[model samples]
Target: MSNSSTGEIRIFDVNPALDRAALAEQFSRNRRIQIRDVLTDESARNLHGILARETPWGLAWHAAEDGPHNIRREDLATLSQDERVAIARKLDTAMRGTDYGFTYAQYPMLDAYLKKWSPGSPQDAVLELINDQPFLDLIREVSGIAELVKADAQATLYGPGHFLAQHDDSHVAEGWRLAYVLNLCNTDWRPEWGGYLNFYREDGDIEQGFRPRFNALNLFAVPQRHAVSYVPPFAPPERLAITGWFRDR
Candidate 1:
């Protein structure tokens, strides 16, 4: 597996049809499964590479989130060890406290983190790496509520003991819609590590979790119940992929 971030190209240039086909196969295998894993060794590693280098930032989060939040800490099996370490360092810097703000602006629909760590920073470069072929393909394929024309993405570099509480991504905009992601972190993740995407069933009784697997896309509707599982203070760093949604104006 190779790093998914090394290449540069137009966001819309990559062929999404192939990606859409691949997802259809996965869906056929597991219909209606709340959480699924999609990234291969190479794809996962590639995700880790991009995420590691993203700029860090202080997002806005309210004590009381209006809707639901779903987090899937993706892994990067396709990247080199050295590259993975580099991304971890950035996450360490962004996530300093046990629970820090995760949204650039306060809204039930959107929140973000980046290696650069500031608003209105350099985004085109990051977007170039983020909108990889498969990742973009999956976002385009996952069908349902319309609004999010494209996924709203940014790396959530959770540093030592850093965590994002529960929240929602509904009505981020008229385009704020579906949620999907291509995880780009290393594969050596653990349970005690505390960075799991906690999903609450509509019933609000049975809450389950989806581990952030590499290359996997978590596509779900907005206004759903969820949260970013805890990331215990890892020494160097811990990270994963974050992306989602297709919108219609």
Candidate 2:
């Protein structure tokens, strides 16, 4: 529900008792992932505003089954007058620590995006604060298939020309029992753009795609192959989404 009054934002508060149980059951039985269009339109829109004013890099857009706001260091020059000013004033300070965000040299996650350009960045601190809610907490408690290691885990942000190859969440070097993507792109995402998230099952077949819709939460198991695909050449806005992994106790 997009309410134009709150500047095109709507907050869909989960009915704690019911929604949590539903989420737990869905994830336990599906064996893949569940896409929930839980947030209202207005809330999604307002999120776009806060995100635009906060991220370190300029926004680039892409669409696929799943997408993240890709903010590049160089794209800063292309920003509109207002956009540039917003970046300068609002993000200048916040961008400092978020520099390294997170890093892994083995896979060359987005080697093409920063190979020659960014020499060194914040090594590992790409993470965020999870919304304090019962539904999310309950899901963790019952999904006995996983152990909660980090509350707000942030792996890395996907910028233009950058992408993470496919691999199972639980199969990553560190091991992931479960996976969750908390979308923070905070923008209007169209389906055709191409940065959709690709998931795979144990059978080595591609699973479903999670469209980069704002405020949508994509939850699934993480023992098989899964990869994040980059958007096409022309897509303008970047993507912003957070990833979380559960460990086995």
Candidate 3:
């Protein structure tokens, strides 16, 4: 968790002692795996703090044909209460239909960093770390995708009423080789709280589901059927994580 000479925030300290071979074998079994304690204890806590306290979250809603629209925090502040509720109603309708849709809070780390949205913020440093050699090397060794050259990231927080409908990560032209979620949730995350990452069989039965475990990294090959379960109203306030795709391009 050390910073640079100029004191730039460098909170990412991935666990250097992970068993890559075992993780690789696990991933090879089903083309997906969740590695626990992916980061050092101090690093994980520091990242959790950044997401919970420092980052300004925004709304990401994808219910229409054109979306996955991002409403920044400033823009969100401009919407009336009724307008917000209307948007929620649209999401509810979309969710009930047989189509792709998702609603959650997010901070697009790569876009923010590239556009200088929050200069010198920890979120920017996190994006840099994910694309850096150490982290990418770790992912490469475990997923056995030696061509994975870069990654894009976004900080996500799934609270009450949030969900993502089932869809295969099939944007092959985008160079997506694998999708990853670095869960930074509270250690006490309960299964009943919802927000599990669910995988499905061709017949639509759930093949597997992974809880939002703190300090765990869930990696799965792209073009697979998956979805994020809805967070019920009584669930905890935050199910936080850093999520994105590891691309070979």
lDDT of 3 by residue, 18-69 (tens): 9999999999999999999998887888888999999899999998573879
Q: If ranked by TM-score, best first, what sequence of candidates would result?
A: 3, 1, 2
Q: What's the lDDT for all of these models?
A: 0.46, 0.48, 0.89
Candidate 2, poorest ten consecutive residues by summed lDDT: 100-109
Task: Estimate, for each residue in 1-249, the C-alpha lDDT of model 2 and write its tens digit.
Answer: 121122223333332334656666666776555445444455444444444443344343223322334555556457689964653343333324332111111111133223533332221212212323333454475465534544434423454344455655445566556677656565466655566678766775776777676666677766656666655556545466645665543
TM-score of each: 0.56, 0.55, 0.95
Predictions ranked by lDDT, top down? 3, 2, 1
Highest-scoring model, lDDT:
3
Backbone clashes for every candidate come to 42, 36, 0
Which model, 1 or 2, shows the larger lDDT?
Answer: 2
What candidate 2 gets wrong by more than 4 Å, as runs, is: 1-18, 38-47, 58-128, 131-136, 141-149, 155-160, 171-175, 185-191, 201-205
| lDDT tens digits, residue span 1-249, model 1 | 111333342222223234455555554452212234354444445445545654333332222222123222232335478854644454444455443233221111234233333343334344543444444445545442322334455555544554555556667566655555445446566777766666676666536666665555566656556676656556236555555454554
Q: Which of the predicted structures, 2 or 3, would earn the higher lDDT when compared with the native? A: 3
The candidate, 2 or 3, that scores higher on TM-score is 3
Full-model lDDT, candidate 2: 0.48
Model 2 / residue 210 / CA error / Å? 1.4
